[model samples]
Target: MEKRLLGKTAIITGSARGIGREYALRMAKLGANVVITDIDLSAGKYKETDIKAKSVKEEVELLGVKSLEFEGDGTDESFVKKVVDDTIDTFGSLDILVNNIGGTGGAGPGLATDMEVEKFRRVIDINLTTTFIFSKHAGKVMKVQKSGKIINVASVAGFVPLFVVQPHYSAGKAAVISLTKTMALELAPYGVTVNAIAPGYISTVKWDAHFEAQIEDLVQKVPLGRIGTTEDCSKVIEFLATDLSDYLTGQTIFVDGGLMELNPSSSKIENYQI
Candidate 1:
């Protein structure tokens, strides 16, 4: 196997678990030193989940690449700056940045009209603002080097409304896509490439039991006839991290198994009117 990302140093936010964890591990295997950070710290009264940052860091180190773990809020400007600073100080250079920190605020489903204004702002802060903070800080370092790759983790829900998750989550993700495009254009002159990966219906242990039925129903809607996995998203991130996608920027790649192409599938025949 060729080491596509050899000599590269990558910082991945929310890498304690889920798709972010997969990205960290896969990048390490491809010969990139990885830095994993997450807001979830098991220090206080909160129970430690399986997808903790320490575990992901350990796994990355096991791959024979140096790994650093940090516990901080992604939405914090100073925190994000520190993450970039630490990456440079420890690794000597920053080559790739994966902005994967985002969530629906653990708030259950609700209509756009009924969603609280505060909750909406929180979602935007976590998903969109954090992306901006990381990209801006990382861009500064990469600009000086004249070469770097930045991959933002968007969601298929941003393109097509899922209706199951909050509308705020979808909107924030859409903003992420827009931010990615803008950054790509701005950073292109410096030899930096920025892009986004919109993953669809990934099956993870974090899904609530009630979502199981919804997940099963969604599988039929996917042309590939199966829900996506964390590894599915990881492979795409891996590609974006390598020189193979150097020419690609200001683009959003949908890892939806062809679901994004069809407006309505056979499964949605009953809802299709056109």
Candidate 2:
């Protein structure tokens, strides 16, 4: 609302759809040149409320901010390095990095007993490892600049074991929270702030039928009386990317509509003393 991100540049991964897309739009709206990448580059394919990188880039341009779109894997170090380098080459500065390129995206049953070793590894690679790879490169540039912001997308499962049976997803997100804190601590002296958003029951187009049917029940369980939205998390990303949150670092801000407060059994809430 304040054009808070003016004169900055950001890279947001997995920005083809959902929360990543929203974050990209919000960043651009606030005047940040954006570099967005999603493995899926199709422009109009997900017309049924799908947000493609092409469409996202177009919107960024419409907002009057420079944008570059890429279709690459964030888990690949080479790919990450190239994008970060290219963003610096083009924008001349790397002011922000939003690691929105994560999710459960599991194909097998999410239960630990039913989860395959490959599935567990894949989930971690996509969610946690990607954050590590991307942040490592971005951190280097930000360190030289002596300023930057990094935001990673974690989930409520990372804090409290959800009833939906996603052990692999839970583990991956939990690791992301840890990664955020360690990065925050490592980067603070250089003026970089690292944080993670643990979203709970966020509404997106790519949900299973069961989640759609159980929406009402899930809302009741949430103390806020409604499912979280992409904008809810994007707003927090906006804060972390700007100077408004300068005093905050190595923090995992829960954007779960008070769900974690209601469920105190989580060891995660205590694990993050950073």
Candidate 3:
């Protein structure tokens, strides 16, 4: 059997570690030449994170495909544009782009009342603005090619109010979903499909410290009674990145173990009765 993404080229931001690294690895496994772009860089040599990117690159290379590592802030307009240009210059063309760079401004989750304005702005810049920059530049390239895949990494917080306490991060992710739909609508005519993946409680190295306790609580809340893995999220992305989803666009798929479908009213009533 042949790989689903054979001969494709992909640019996955934040590919240094965590979910982004998983995306790079999974795409490469499918025979896609991946560009691992991250904001983190080392001084003398590639750090552990960069090593992860290099390892994926090596694995892909072993499969007879090319890979590259790029270090830069995905939110910067010039940097993002240059990444798109460099990928085309080096690989000859661009096929897929995964906007996987985002976080809670390093503050974890905080109450809306205590969140600072600057922190809120920074979160928006990192999550929402970065998606815009990549989509805008990559959209142009894909339009010219007349065929491309743009997958924005959104969060389940975008659909429900799960991250309401962390207003900034929640708002930013919500914007990502909205932007995904808008881009999908605009790019549909150009033969390009744009979609968003909204993942919930995915286990990554970044959350390893509190993984166990968080998983227990999260599982109790989820209908599936389990937290998601990086592979779980990657599977949905694989579908969106291929012709398997050619007719699907302007949509957000939540890979949350059915967490979003739960009835808040029923749960609340049960709690009150108890």
Candidate 4:
């Protein structure tokens, strides 16, 4: 770790567990003061990733960087604004914002036609609306300061249909990718870079269980012949968060192990419902 993000402050949404947790840890390891926010700080228990520290905030603090923890709805504009305000109040600067709060959000049919309206809306709010609200408040600060990094986490499902039934998830992520581009254009002049990372078949604790039976079949579909990991996704965030990407903005880097390039599909396993 070369401390690429030394002295910066980063706020990662839904960072109590899963890929979001990885983002928090990686940024902290790079020396950024990390703020962890999620509806449940103990969310990792649901997926069996809870660490000895019991929470991501403590985990980050153990890495020798300042850490802030907030428990709230990432979609709620008020809470998001407070988080942004507090981040600036505490760290004196908000250098990075990773909009990582999102998920499939339902175990229903996930069909575009008959899925419950509530489920569809939940997916969109968590994925797209949260991103918008965070960026709006953070962009205000970054614009005035004229330097910042905003990374939106998307999914390969946004680019192509999935063997899993996640039309709502797909639609929400697609919107995130589009939102990244538009945000980039608006913030570029202010020296703020906005980018999105679309991950494919990542094997998080929850996902590992969800795709347990289909892992082999799914790996075969990926051109790289492997499932992606949280580290794989975090590396892209590292790039977008650091000065290495000073010249890049409004881009969606696919951390899919070449699965997207192959136009992936899985016929061996039955349609997995999310």
- Structure candidate 1, residue pairs in collision: none
Q: Give me the displacement of residue 272 in model 4, in angstroms.
A: 2.4
Native-referenced Cα lDDT, model 4: 0.88
Which candidate should be chosen as best, given lDDT against the real structure?
4
Per-model TM-score versus the true fold: 0.91, 0.91, 0.89, 0.94
For model 2, the superposed segments whose C-alpha errors exceed 4 Å read 48-54, 208-210, 263-274
> Residue 111 lDDT in model 2?
61
Residue-wise lDDT of candidate 3 within 1-274, one digit each (tens)?
2588888999998876778877887888888999978887332134334343245556557666789877888878999989999999998789999999888747566666887888888999999999999999999999999999999999877766564456777789999999998998899999999999999778765655545555565577777777788889999989999889989999899898877777342122111100
Model 1 Cα displacement at 172 (Å)? 0.2
Name the runs in model 4 displaced over 4 angstroms. Answer: 46-50, 263-270
**lDDT (Cα atoms) of all candidates against the true structure:** 0.82, 0.82, 0.80, 0.88
Candidate 4 shows a clash count of: 0
- RMSD to true structure for each model, in Å: 4.0, 4.5, 4.2, 2.1
TM-score of 2: 0.91
* Cα displacement (Å) at residue 173, model 4: 0.4
| Model 4, C-alpha of 70: deviation from truth (Å) | 0.4
